[model samples]
Target: METKKLLKAAAGAMIVAFAISACQTKKTATGQNADPAHNSMNSVDWAGTYQGTLPCADCPGIRYTITLKDDDTYVLKTRYLEKGDSVFTESGTFAWDENGGKITLADRGEKFQVGENKLFHLDMEGNRITGSLAEHYVLTKMTDQITDRYWKLIEVGGQAVADGSTQKEPYIQLNSEGNRVEATGGCNGMGGTYELKEPNRISFSQLIGTLMACENMEVENGLKRALESADSYHVQGDTLQLFRARMAPLAKFVAKGK
Candidate 1:
């Protein structure tokens, strides 16, 4: 009877030991199997809005905003600054490369690279993007609530267009309300009304302004032409580009504030 009891105790101890060994082995295997995906997610948390500024050879610094979607997709919007003008915004998309620990952005046929800790830098990470950077964060995943904002222009192409052609000098200004428009003809301030159209379009009409005589008239001539010839408008980044139904290239403006 004693021998049988001892044999039963030994068997129970062996079973418990085997169970412990199996569990340890499973844990080790799991850790080893976690490759790029685990490392990528561990590095950058790309769930919010990202904004930054990068240098461009043709312009000042270009600012950008990137929104990550819940579905693992992303939208990238950027701005290009011109000399003495508002910035221009260019938008596109991107994807996460888990194993590579970097986000692969769509460059519209432009080449981009991704690597661990080698991503472009960014400014603040929040609802409002502010600051400058040379690199963007490498995205790992995206959510659905990413696309929510639309950009508006306070000034027409790089310069403002006035209503009259008689001023001495041509100059532009966005009224204080930012809703009204006006400009300096060579001699006086011209005024006008404008509207935002559908699907990234804008128009100006019911235009009227004051006439005056001044020393300079070149700007007055151009301002008068811009107002009469203006047909359509589009806003990108801080830069605004105007169009004239196959007549001319129109005017371009940057955002009012820096």
Candidate 2:
């Protein structure tokens, strides 16, 4: 009877040891105690165009347009309004911070915290700005499409292009089919080929327009000049702005009907 009791106790001990070992193996395989990592780089849909007007001391404001791509590259453009017609543009790869919450521009050393549909500008030390001006440092994402729509010229070189000033309101249409661009500069019909080299970079070529001249050719002349000089563009909601380098927009347009 004593031998049988000892045998039973030994079997029980073996079963308990096997069960504890299996439990530990399961925990290790499933990673039950590990914490999952989450950050803006993995959680946010951050690759897109962002734009805002930052405060400036000597000028009205600094217009900023930045484009971040999925390939870890970026394009940054800035214009100091009321200062001069010069747009500063920079492009290069960007690096994510250790925690993957922020990005530092490779060329400018500028840092921005990635957020949902926006970016928060950080100071040189990588801290968010404080006080009343903090709100002005945000850059909102732009999701509007720039092609296959009628863009009516609203302002040209800081001057408003009034409706009915010409036979046909000045407008441009970018067709995605053949990369063709068709326009009417308030009076004459114009056709050209346009190429979008990068996210915001654009160039117009093979431009040919009607030879007829109107009495007031101011709008037409300005529109043509804007098209020829524009090397970059910005789209915010229904508005489209064409720019050269980092200067102010040479021309601004609004989408008409859908």
Candidate 3:
């Protein structure tokens, strides 16, 4: 009877030890504690501009540049080396693969594997490279956001803004300090505070404009409506595009200074 009691106690102690060890075990990709979820990538993680000098069959090389915006849209710019000054540009949407480790261009179905500040040119079959030229197929990221500068209103709802040929053009200045937004509301002097809610999300509030109504009231009204409706923004090269909640751009601005 005493031996039986001892056996029970020993079994209880063994169970306790096992439980403690299990509690300390960390989950790994192949471990018993691993999670079933896979392929998690947010907009900020996948959005950026990537560039590389890709090999070409006819030309010396192709300077490949692709801008990945948070809106799932992408712009592909390519320049043929030793060919001409002509630049080929294409813009469309992109989708992530099942693993989230790759993105497929919607227009051409080309696949690119995502990595740390790099994108690998993958085969159409969406597999990793195993050849001598594998190293050269990688593109490095140039940064996703642009620096703050004086941005002049260039386009309003897809129409090109006049270059002050007749009237003075509208302009805006975004100060890095305190999220202040100052601009010419096409006809009046405007000032406001902006909120950068996220990498892609932005909001403007407390906007006030002068009452000195100018001749171009239509332009002024358009600018005010666009600014108030803007909920997101994207900076591509020298251009800044303001968008309103899942819709097309409300306004587009270009940096005036070098």
Candidate 4:
């Protein structure tokens, strides 16, 4: 009888050990299947400025611009079109959701779903907005370089561009497609091709413009001269400076609606 009892105890111990080993094996398999590498926080190049016009019931629309930094901070600017020129600015930290696909603004509890070169505005419940207006909630990421933006001419020949000096605001847009450039010196429209060589070296060619004369051709003439002589360029934040050799900046521009 004693021998039988000892045999039974040994068999029971073996069964428990086998059960524990099987559990561990199952756990290891489950862990291997969990993919943490494909999330937006790790996979997406999400840092940059994103801009869009969000819908508003009482106003025309809200120009929303949000800049996300790699350090998990954000700057939000909003302007109600046709309301006033005042731009509301907000700055604060943001935290990603547990799934790493969504971020919440710490100050206002606003949420946005992070995606490739875009952000989807989420509702209060942290869910994507649905229906016809859904597409309007998307914000496109802006390039960090001096391309595909409206650069308003603020200074030319070391002088500030006065308000109402020209019929329209002086601005330039560098289109990435075919490296084309379009500008208005607050009067006649101008078009040209621009080449960006090396890091900051730049040149404009095939410049053409409308012959219509305006009351104030000073800004327009200066702009053309600056473009012809600019050999290098510098972009700091929203400001762009054109340089001729090592001399002072020939002209300065600020990114519009930045």
For this target, which candidate reaches the highest TM-score against the unseen true structure? 4
Clashing pairs in 2: 86-246, 86-247, 87-246, 87-247, 88-246
Q: What is the number of backbone collisions in each predicted candidate, taken in the order shown?
A: 28, 5, 0, 0
Q: Candidate 3, after superposition: displacement of residue 100 in Å?
A: 1.5
**Per-residue C-alpha lDDT of model 4 across residues 7-123, encoded as one tens digit per residue:** 999999999999999988887554443346777899999988898999999999998878888999887878888897677878889999876789999979999999999999999
- RMSD in angstroms between candidate 2 and the native structure over all alpha carbons: 12.1
In candidate 2, what are the lDDT values of residues 28-104, reduced to their tens digit? Answer: 55545323365788888998789899999988899988888899988787889887767777778999987778899
**Rank order by lDDT, top first?**
4, 2, 3, 1
Report the candidate with higher TM-score, 2 versus 4: 4
What local lDDT score does residue 151 receive in model 2, on the 0 to 100 scale?
98
For model 1 the local lDDT of residue 102 reads 39
Compared with the true structure, what per-residue lDDT tens digits does model 3 show for residues 194-213? Answer: 76533578888999988885
**Which 10 consecutive residues of model 2 have the lowest summed lDDT?**
28-37
Q: Estimate the overall C-alpha local distance difference test score of candidate 3.
A: 0.75
lDDT (0-100) at residue 55 of candidate 4? 97
Candidate 3: lDDT of 173?
A: 77
Error of 3 at 64 (Å): 1.0
The residue pairs that clash in candidate 4, if any, are none
